[model samples]
Target: MKRFVILIFIISLLFTGCWDKREINQLAFVQGLGIERGKDDMIHLIVQILKPGLLAAGGGGAGGTGGGSAVGKPYAVFQASGVDFAKAFANLNDELPRSLFMQYNEIIFLEEKFARSGIYKTLDFMTRNPEFRRTAYILVVTGGSLQELFDLPNTKQLERYPYKEVLGMIENQKNTSSSYVCDLNEFLEMLEIPKEAPITGRLEIVKKDGKAIGVRMAGSAVFNNDKLVGFLEEQDTKAIMTLKNKLRRSTLTLDKGLKGEKVHISFVVIKAHTDIIPKVKGKDIFFDIKINIETHMNEQESKYDLTEPKNLEKLQLLINDKIKQGIEHALFVLQKKYNADVVGFINILHQKNPKLWKEVEKDWDKIYPEVKFNVTVKSIVRRTGLSSKPIQPR
Candidate 1:
């Protein structure tokens, strides 16, 4: 029994040893930033790999200390191309001894041309890769190369790129409802459904002094079957946010009967709700969307009496009109200009009235351009900031 126990202890020690061992110092830490493109019918991969040592040193300073981003030869931005994504990555491995690791990858940028060609193939690689995170943010770059995106200046002190900085800003903004950070799984799920259109973050390089300077989230890219269909500008994106009940705290400027003077009102979204009702009459599908929004004034530019019911009524009407117009324009652009149903209105109709959807499912896109949509926006301005009256005296 003593001999058996000794043998068993030896076996346990052997099993405890790591069979697949890797040193953190030898591995490259990827900080969620990459760009994907196509050239000569092959996949092009550009990775913005993070430098851990520099990141550590920079973060070690005072919490808010700043000194023009850590100056270490820390990050290595590289590019490679091949017939398949894996092969391209494998080719990259030939250059560096350490394997290409993407566990911390945060954002995926797809060029417009490549997106129009079809993203399913590239997305397949990302989704199937065991090491890739399912929640990495996805963006569509307009009229720029993967190299251009990588060349943007690093203004943050933590050795971060513009892509990460912009996304951080959007996440930290007061209005967080409509502005969501989409990942591989979320985008793929939305694309798989036939009735829904997928939206992705849009990026563009802003140049200054003959150099790539900054990055901006221009708007949202509306997709149809993984193809580039169209984009919703800033205003349209905001409108979609309102309809989707995603607005956090946004300002609405209104013309208050004064020529060349407008009232800038900041409001925090208190409550938001949306309802869709479908009606069919002789092959015509009519959708009525009712949106109820409640807000508190964060600021009022002009002097106005808040206690007056009449003024409040006018303010409510103006808010409703602005929201309605924004929605109407977005829908029109989606239907006529892009021929894409990005708002998932068709899906809503199908869910609410499946029978009608079944009948029109086959020809929904063809009929979408002609479908009549009625939108009703109801807004209630519940509070007028800390002071009941505007600071500017009447």
Candidate 2:
């Protein structure tokens, strides 16, 4: 009987609930975080805290809207400043009654000014902190106030949080291929690579009468090490994504001369592939880039039937030219204009030809500009949409 009681007591200890469990009511859930430079060289931190009470009220199909946003704001934004991120966070925590919970944070916004100044310290702090979430998507805020971005009224009817709207925007990149998105982990990994620069989605403010009305994620912010070097516009961003093989799906439009008249042709790119081969001829180094694309004819404004083999072949050639031009433009900007290698050129050489990489690793910066690229593109229009040819005007 004594042994049985001791065994039972020891088993009960194993079933003890979480030792440091925190009640939901005692924690403030942070949905998003924004960092920027402040006056007197202080670190400015902005946090978006979820309002549980409002969320609860918005539930149960409120107002026949089926769980839409509440009448009032579902989140609140707060800002604090200090000499460093840790102190800034401590100051912010003092203003709230509940402890800040950041494990659920979905987004991290770095203001343009702060990114330009340098993001190494901020990134280091985040990586070192156990509470910070490394999976959070990182964005560079431009042409707006970080606070306003967090506090802006939700335009999406079903979204209860501003960050969710941003998430949807980021998700659209899979189809649009107009912007670049990078999470904390991916950005850090890029930074650690040699001769490879880091980039993040560009979040720009849209305003009405000098007040921020909304935000748009278009283009990308390029970086050299941890500092901002420049930006890639939407077209350039698309080209870069294509070269990097990150473009999942995209639409392209071209005006081609058909039957002695110019007509518009739209295509939906369903598949794309890019290959880069590094070669060394004596002391000179160069690369061969081949881009293969498969697209479907989406729209035709003319009466001509482009599905015919000859016409289709001509259309494919035009598409190949257009894609080639875009890729060349992107290469010119990345190599000649910025001199930043964000396209992973060094990685290819290192993986394929380590011996050559070792010899040029010391003076890659000087050698990269002179490195020529031989580009070839092959595009095919696989299928035409419902209407093979446009209706006659007759």
- Model 2 residue 333 CA deviation (Å) reads 0.8
Local accuracy of candidate 2 as per-residue lDDT tens digits, 263-369: 78889999999999998888888899999999998888777776567877877888998898998888888888877888889888999999999988878888887
Clashes of each: 5, 0
The CA lDDT of each predicted structure is: 0.72, 0.85
Model 1's C-alpha root-mean-square deviation from the true structure amounts to 4.0
| Model 2 segments more than 4 A misplaced | 1-19, 55-71, 155-158, 258-261
Per-residue C-alpha lDDT of model 1 across residues 1-394, encoded as one tens digit per residue: 9999999999999889688677765666665445465667887777766555565666422112343355743466877788877788777767775666777676777877777778887778777778788887788877567687776655622434544565565575435443434678888888987867788777776776656766666778888888878788877877776665566666665655222356566666677787778887786788888988888877767676778888788778878887788889988888899888776777888889888788878888798889888999899998886677756645
The alpha-carbon deviation from the true structure for residue 309 of candidate 2, after best TM-score superposition, in angstroms, is 1.0
Tell me the deviation in Å of residue 279 in model 2: 1.0
TM-score of candidate 2 to 2 decimals: 0.91
Give the candidate number with the greatest TM-score.
2
Q: Give, for candidate 2, the lowest lDDT window spanning 10 residues.
A: 60-69
